[model samples]
Target: MKTSSPNTLTEKLKSRVVLIALFVGSMWAVFFLSVALPFLHLNEHGVVPRSLDGLQGILFAPWLHASVGHIAANTSGLVVLGWLCTWPNIAGFWRATIGAMLGAGLCAWLFGAPYSVHIGASGLVFGYAGHLVARGYYTRNLVSILVALVVVSSYGLSLLFGVLPIYPDVSWQSHVGGVLGGVLAARAGAGAANRVRVR
Candidate 1:
């Protein structure tokens, strides 16, 4: 059986790291650009509940933020959880991200206050966490289970509280929707893997 050499594995790891860095870098870039050009009003692009114009936020909201503190709060979660999603394969990472974005955006639009605009990568961060945890449940593998346990131990409280509507400024709807999306993605991925194995 031919296997990847050490150098190849190292290269693959480096590539994945670069991908994560680029993604996070893009978020920072957007934040700085929005700050520098306030006239652009980039934040206005965020999900505006039930408004026809706000539908665009489904694709743009995850890339927008209100302030440095807002983006900073989400940065660490995105970096750590995003890196975790890249494991086993890179396709999984995209699945989680896209799923999270759509789910979170839709939920915020559906459930958010009538006049409020929801923005932030917190939804995606929550989505990554949800994906990792659900992947363990669906895959029933030792590595996945270990990863899930780590997530639970580290983020259990946040995950629980984040979905509740206790904080007026926070979008619990997005977090809940992101988690649901991540779980569904995990289920879909597991089903596809099972079919592939069966064939």
Candidate 2:
């Protein structure tokens, strides 16, 4: 493992601050819609909402939410996972996002039934969860293991309830799908991290 550069902590911490700002900015924009935008529910539809139609289909869903509570929960999760995965670089950040997208998109297409609408960053969260666990296993990194432990012990594992049909609107398909994507991302990230260190 690489040793931390004490002098670089300032730069790394500054980058982390920027990441926090971005996270807040995104939430603020979405929250604004949920509040000021009376019809915000229009975009709440999963991944461009089948209603929107066309290339817009590619945009991520869960960037919107049904209510303040919804966005609040996702915001918290993103901050926690975002910080954990992207310690001193944007590579992990984008990697996790792509992983989430891949996980959510595939699961929505494969497991999600046609005509059904799925939304929420829960899929992304699951992906982050899977990525953290797998990354830790692949690299034998302490931080990754610690983050995964915290995620499983706290939010990710207990939320299996949300994945079940106990609630009519929950999209377990997205949840499960995101997790699968995260696993793939973790494998890729481990290899990438290793390559970077060697050269």
Candidate 1 lDDT: 0.93
**For residues 91-170, could you state the per-residue lDDT of candidate 2 as single tens digits?**
87778778876777666656665566666677777777777777778878787678777877887544577556566677
Over the stretch 89-159, how does candidate 1's per-residue lDDT look in tens digits?
Answer: 99999999998998899999999999899999999989999999999999998999999999999999999
Give per-model TM-scores: 0.97, 0.81
Q: Candidate 2 clash total? A: 0
In order, the Cα lDDT scores of the candidates are 0.93, 0.69
Off by over 4 Å in 2: 1-7, 39-41, 48-58, 196-199
Identify the candidate with maximal TM-score. 1
Candidate 1, pairs of clashing residues:
none
